[model samples]
Target: LHCGTGKVSYVGGNSKSPALFISLLKRLKATYRRAKTITLIVDNYIIHKSRETERWLKENPKFRVIYQPVYSPRVNHVERLWQALHDTITRNHQCRS
Candidate 1:
């Protein structure tokens, strides 16, 4: 869930945030028309293994979800993006809502 900085918060989540992840996917696919396969790298969360999600994955082989091992946030590029956003916000004192 990548979003431009604003009043709205775009959230990318780990296994702990299933609803947010699913919601982000819905938002992404709503207007997306490309036929290319989607490759996703994520942390291992229990929700990724949910029955419903698994069924969806089976039905959609074009979407690939790769789960990284635990305690490896440093390897996730989203962490760097968040850090950059934090730095930009803190430098301007405009992070708080």
Candidate 2:
């Protein structure tokens, strides 16, 4: 997802979520192909430290992860997006599988 100022992307779940991170890298590449480097702000999620992810990062020198401090939701701007999304979709909302 993207806020007006900058983009906010994420990968969730467990080790099975590598695909999400891969997709996010693709988006970052496409979105900032001409830029020198792309700075990514993220939480300290364990999957982010997986061997696969580490390998990908090792090869992709242009990409960097800036980890947010633990337990500090207020420092995460992406949480603002979640708050806004929640406020906008109040009541009668359901996730259909």
Candidate with top lDDT is 2
lDDT of 1 by residue, 1-97 (tens): 3333323334555434557666655554553437466566666667666776677678867777888874465677676665786787756683334
Give stretches of model 1 more than 4 Å off.
Answer: 1-19, 83-97
lDDT of every model, 2 decimals: 0.60, 0.70
On TM-score, the candidate that comes out on top is: 2
lDDT digits (tens) for residues 1-97 of candidate 2:
5445655654444445656676678677788799798777777776566677778888888987888864466898776777787788744686553
Per-candidate TM vs. native? 0.56, 0.71
Instruction: Note the clash tally of each candidate.
Output: 1, 0
